[model samples]
Target: MKAMILAAGLGTRLRPLTLDRPKPLVDVHGRPLIEYNLLLLRRYGIVDVIINLHHQGDALRAALGSGDTLGVRIVYSPEDPLLDTGGAIKNAASLLGDDDFLVLNGDTIIDLPLDALLAAHRARRAAATLVLRHDPEQQRYGLVEIDGEERIRRFLGRPAEVETALVPYMFAGVHVLSSRVLDYMPDPGTTFSITRATYPAMLAADEGLYGFPFAGFWRVIDTAADLARANAILEERPPLHFL
Candidate 1:
């Protein structure tokens, strides 16, 4: 399957570490953070990759040229003015082709079972399946509430209807989306967020947007403290299986 890594963010929270290099290139235990993500995707047999680049985009392109040495074919979707999540994916639509594809946020690290997630997506016949986790601080992030069957009944920390009882779960920065889902997205140049715009729209339309709940090791490197914590975790439990 094809995959897209959203590596174009400014990473303002990363500060000095990102001042010299992009957040994807920031070292998280010896290797660049995005390298670990690429390696994990490679292990899952995702060979074709499209990475969106901005804020030192050229440097990232240079470092990961073609991804040949790493055994994956790399393609770039360079953004002159970086688009948000939905926009980036829409901009890369041609490269992604017309099929179901996986999207990953480059700053997050998670040990997700690809096969299971994909199977769940297919079985539920969902337009998109977001990987989710139970976090009490769901309000802080864009949260989703799933029904017994994992269909997202609520989004963005809001209840969809009167009958729906919201069950709190935070988005895990990973998604399996069908190409048809793009039809609901705004124009490529429009500043839209998949979490904020597309998914909510889908929910309102009664489309089957589900959540794949996974209880695994996951972290998002949004700030210096998060980076340090990821380094500590990697040092304590180096993921050999990922390699």
Candidate 2:
């Protein structure tokens, strides 16, 4: 399996902590935030990885050179002007090759059965399978609606109106995407968002978009409080089983 870590964000939410380093490089329990994702990918036996870089790109590069220490072959796609999720993936289309690949947010720490997620994606033959979780603050993160069959029906808050009062599920910042979904993305070199643009289009077209609900440990460290909480969690439970 192959994976891509979306680490190109400017980390504006993290402010002072990110001023010296990228959000992915922010220290969490004495380990870089991105390290948790890398280790998880390694745990799943996905050794080929690409990381998109922007703010503090050099520091990230210096922090994890070639992914050798982590037992993964790492390549970088540095965007001059940071491209959002859609554009970043399109920019690395060639490197990702013509197969399904995993996408993980650098700021998130999650421990779930990735193998099962892959199995479900293959079984459904979905073009894009998002890992969803029931977050109480769904509105804060934006919601995704899924049907009985787990097909993604809509991206809440989009321009389109959803007739049904569908329950909202938060995107877990993890995705298993088939290469063909890249076609739904805007032209390469253009800044775009997968949620606001590509995903809505895919749902409209009835493409094979699905969701896998996960009830496990997942945290996104976007603010100082989040960072502190993560550190506290690690302090209470040193050496997370996932890592």
Candidate 3:
């Protein structure tokens, strides 16, 4: 399987620390943030990894050289004007190729059962399976509503309104997507957020998009406080214990 990590963000939220290094290269428990994701991908037997870079991109490139130490082949998609999530994925389409691949946020730390998520994706025969978790504060972030069969009924903060018994779950910054999803995106654009544009279109078309609910430890490390919490958790005990 192949995968791409969206790492081109400027890390505006993580100031001072990110001023000198990219968010992906920011130290957390002695290892660069992106390194953890690479190791996790290696464990899942996914070696073909593509990462996009912009903020302190050269440092990140130097730090991750060829991913040899991590047992994976790392490829880079260097973007000049930072592209948003949808734009970055669309820009790296050639590297992603013509099949389904895993997409994850470079800064998110989550102990996801990759095999289980993939299995659930295939069973549902979904066009895309979003790794979702039911968070009480789901309103803070973009939410996805899924039915009993796990098919996505609607995406929050979008125009598509569904009257079904929909449970809102926060997107876990991880997904298994078919290349076909790009069909809804423009070839070249300034910036586009996938949640704001693509997923809603898919939902309106009644396309098979499902949520892979995982009640596990997951954190999106964007601010310094998030990094501190992660370090405390990882330093005090092994991450596997929480899993």
Candidate 4:
């Protein structure tokens, strides 16, 4: 399976650091932030990666050229005007092909069980499966409600679904989506979000969307404080399991 790492954001919150390089290149531990993502993919045996670049696009290629040392083949999709999550994927549709592919946030760190996520995605036969996490700030991030069967019933509170006893979780910025999801996107070359635009439409159409509940280490590197927290955590407990 192929994976696409979403690394095109402006990283405006990161300020000075991002002013130097892209968010994915921000130093986390000894490797670039995106290197951890690459290592994780190679660890799970998914070596073909598509990284969408916009902010500091040249630095990404310069840092990891051909991906030989890292053991993964990278295909870059440069967005001149910048595409949102949904549109970015749509732009790279040719590289992803017909198979269901994985999308990951390039600036976030997560020790996701890729094999398990893949298995659950296939078993549920979902059109898309988002990795969900329980957090006090779930609402702050965005509320995603899932049924007892692990199927996503509401995305960011849309379609006006009845309230259920099921607990809501925040999106983990990692998901496996069928290529068919691209069909739900707007006109070609349009900038839109998969969660904000395509997802609600899919939910209204009754397309299967599920969630994989995760209770492991996950962190976002959007601000200096967030980066400091991640660095502190890594110093204390190294993820020996990940590559």
TM-score of 2: 0.95
RMSD, every candidate, angstroms:
2.4, 1.9, 2.6, 2.3
Against the hidden true structure, what lDDT does model 4 obtain? 0.88
Expressed as tens digits, the lDDT of each residue in 148-217 for candidate 3 is: 8788877776232443355578788899998889898888545788888888888888788998999987
lDDT of each: 0.88, 0.88, 0.85, 0.88
Q: 106-141, model 2: which lDDT tens digit per residue?
A: 899998788999999999999999999887655557
Better of 3 and 4 by TM-score: 4
Cα lDDT tens digits, model 4, 32-137, are 9999889999999999999999999999889988899999999999997988888899999989999999999898788888999999999988999999999765
Residue 111 accuracy (lDDT) in model 2: 81
lDDT of 1 by residue, 1-243 (tens): 899999999999999889989999999889898987798889999999999998999999999999999999999998878789999999999999998999999998888888899999999888999999976544556777888888888775432223335667888899999998899887787768888888888888999999999888888898999899889988898574676
In order of appearance, the predictions have TM-scores of 0.94, 0.95, 0.92, 0.95
* For model 2, the run of ten residues with the poorest summed lDDT: 157-166
